[model samples]
Target: MTSTLVENHFRIGKLPHIWCPGCGHGIIMRSIAVAIDELGYDKNDVCVVSGIGCSSRAPGYMDFNTLHTLHGRALAYATGVKMANPDLKVIVITGDGDCAAIGGNHLIHASRRNIDITTVVFNNNIYGMTGGQYSPTTPTGEKGTTAPFGNIDRNFDLCNLAKGAGATYVARSTAYHANMVKQQVKAALENKGFSFVEAVSICPTYYGRKNKKGDAVSMMEYLKNSTVNVKAADKLPKEKLEGKFLVGEFYKSEEPEYTEEYKKIIDSFQKER
Candidate 1:
């Protein structure tokens, strides 16, 4: 029953994803599947590592090798996995909270090291797994259960964070732009260093209802209308740019992957010895 979608990539008896209706995580998951299938990597050679969150549930349904790690530990575990077996293609799927809040150090360091791994941040802007608490990526001035009046803390611009932390490939996409998301994820996978894909997802159950976003459909519409391509985005006049957001491949560059670079240093020292 393998469709052209992921003939080699799809797992056995893992159909019917269980995410809530209108949850953007499912869309991101499909895009990932498509991207991996396009990469032509065998399912056995790929592993999906995830931390505790709604997004983390993704690995469970995937047919390929998967690891459901502790809260905020996806990066650490994935780092170990890559270090132990450099032949494996590891992908980390984590929510905004899991990746940006408690696991922030791991996320930053992994990018700095430029390990041969791909990180996909399902940035739904709030903690969807738990009862909607404010998250590091939640928009400022938005009301949450904790921030009844309004959120005062500024949110981390995830794309900027990844780029600043030295990730070799950084991209932003959304459920609205499903095809674009696939393209960016594929690009990241093809790259040979720390690759990142920040797919802004929709959380109607938490973020939408709390912010009076109407419903899942409305929130999705918002995501669609909010984004602009990076190139055209920069060209937008200042006044027109207000209240709008960009979602596209932001930056990409080739750099020495940490593992390969370390091997080079070791080889050099061995020659001297």
Candidate 2:
């Protein structure tokens, strides 16, 4: 079944990707492909844009109109693509560092506009591709090559950031939860306004070794045991939910999408002219 999915959705020539053994990015990438395949979207009408990072390599393997853009600028390019041809389905594949750090301003504005684009953030905590630096989403006190003495910075709750910035749809899942990740990606794609999905992936090669968090399988197990459903989370007290994280759809609303609103203004101006 997995082989069939890869054969159907990936570019055959692009096999043998560079991700490390047991790295979760491959799983997340496959989940995205599964979601797109399940939606039965026309390849010609699908635009996969990505920034410079390990996760950004996803668009290269995908069978779509793909753009491997500058570091931290995937969202900017995707916004232009969606605005230029509103009919196209634009999906931005970004990493935690690429999106939440360097391209953070773009993220905020895009969500505020409620642009009709689906953004998938692969949050592996550390910057896996760039020598294992601590990223904006890296957990506090977690050790990275850049933080050998343990990091003191606070991590970003990306789901909350998207929701607060006015994104109409937002969800989160881990690479270990393959089916849930696929479903979340599908829901993001179907939403008309801006949608954000955070896939908490594992970087066993770097993050695990540096932090002594065991191997890939153990990290995946941690994800499974540490996450609670948002619905169930609400019933728990703040202290009880201290160490655990919330997963599942965090927010959804039927707001007016930016492109549609722009079209209305253009139509009005044309009538006056």
Candidate 3:
């Protein structure tokens, strides 16, 4: 693939990223950059926000107004930024643990309010940063440092969570599908209200070794083969979808953006006065 499109967008001095060799986070980050490029968004008009985790490190390389916030607090910071300056194109880069666990309440409310910010959750299913702990999206029976015996806890379907919570756009893609990731992210960016894209990523160093899922290549291939498009999944029998997940845009709707609604309220108050 050509680097021309994303080359200028990144800080070349930060060339060697801290992510593990073969980690999918890098691919996801590149996909986001590609989406931004395709959408013709001016770098100055974009703000990238992230929470603590491996996935959150993306903002360090991207040459944009970036915020590295507290763990699971990316949404809160992004919310504040967008509310204060609705003209900025706010995009959030978060991890499964950061978005679905401690930051989950923020995720729900952000979607509930239909805030004008696009979120991309790197769903690696395990916390690769602070140690290889199983996160909320960890598949049942998956092994991690904290779940050496295999996790029995139910996993959260992030896309469904966002859609159900009222996000105007919701989609899912995997790192293996780089082009699809870019497309989904671009679509999310174009949504007026809250938009979410879940990028299923691979953590080869920790999650892979702990679970014996083979190398990063194998894990990526698993994501490619194990997931069906949402349309195809609908036609499949329940038994066929037992071990497979669905990808592609699952939901979308028109809604009043939170910032826009807030502005209307302020305007009404001024008129009343």
Candidate 4:
């Protein structure tokens, strides 16, 4: 039987998601749901948006105001939703390819605007839903169907990109660190301006098989061993940190949110009238 949390937050009929066995997207999705539940936000006041990709399917299963929009347009639609109804808590669930490839422009602009929306990127490195193509976040030299000779492009550190683009809150966590993902997501949702959380996930069917990354268990174990918390990383020696990625909050600051600023202009015009 599904837990009460799942029953409450997820569509009961949508149980048994379609993700491949060992895919880490489910864990990331669960983390998002848990974060929302913990925050006690009324489901009707929450809007979940998603673009086309493996991870984009999340909003379909979630029991909330949802928009399964066009590929790479999740953020655009989310921005409109927030502007139209500032009272709604908007959260976007996007995949690496969906957000960082065709949707990259939207991602940067949303961060730049410091809009009041939370974005959770389920980054599985490769384009799992689109035939295992190399994505913007696929590491250099990683194998993908399109890059069987090995991907030569440099990968993006999404957190860095969001921070540079002016996101008020930025953080990263792997699906292996379920609790950390939940914590970061909770913090991101609570922030009043643009927020981003990268949930590094595994694609056992595609990325794993193509890259010879073993099974789901091996990929999960790799995540457990290859990441360090930002706080602990600060205390560890450089040598100890080599080859390990830093997880946890990287940047956060209060900012004038775009919606709020826009409202100020509207109120001024109304007073003038």
| Top of the candidates by TM-score | 4
Q: Put down candidate 3 lDDT per residue, 139-228, tens digits, no spaces.
A: 899898999999999999899899999999999999999999999999999889899999999999998999889999999889988999
lDDT of 4: 0.96
lDDT of 1 by residue, 174-256 (tens): 98788888999899988999999999999898889899997889988998887778889777888887888888888899888
TM-score of 3: 0.97
Candidate 3: deviation at residue 265, Å? Answer: 1.1
The residue-by-residue lDDT of candidate 4 on 1-273, one tens digit each, is 779999999998987899999999999999999999999999999999999999999999999999999999999999999999999999999999999999999999999999999999999999998889999999999999999999999999999999999999999999999999999999999999999999999999999999999999999999999999999998899999998999999999998999999999999999998
- Return the TM-score for candidate 2, rounded to 2 decimals: 0.96
Off by over 4 Å in 3: none
For every model in order, what is the number of clashing pairs? 1, 0, 0, 0
Cα lDDT computed for each candidate against the true fold = 0.89, 0.93, 0.93, 0.96
TM-score of each: 0.94, 0.96, 0.97, 0.99
Model 2, stretches more than 4 Å misplaced? 237-240
lDDT accuracy of residue 146 in candidate 2 = 91
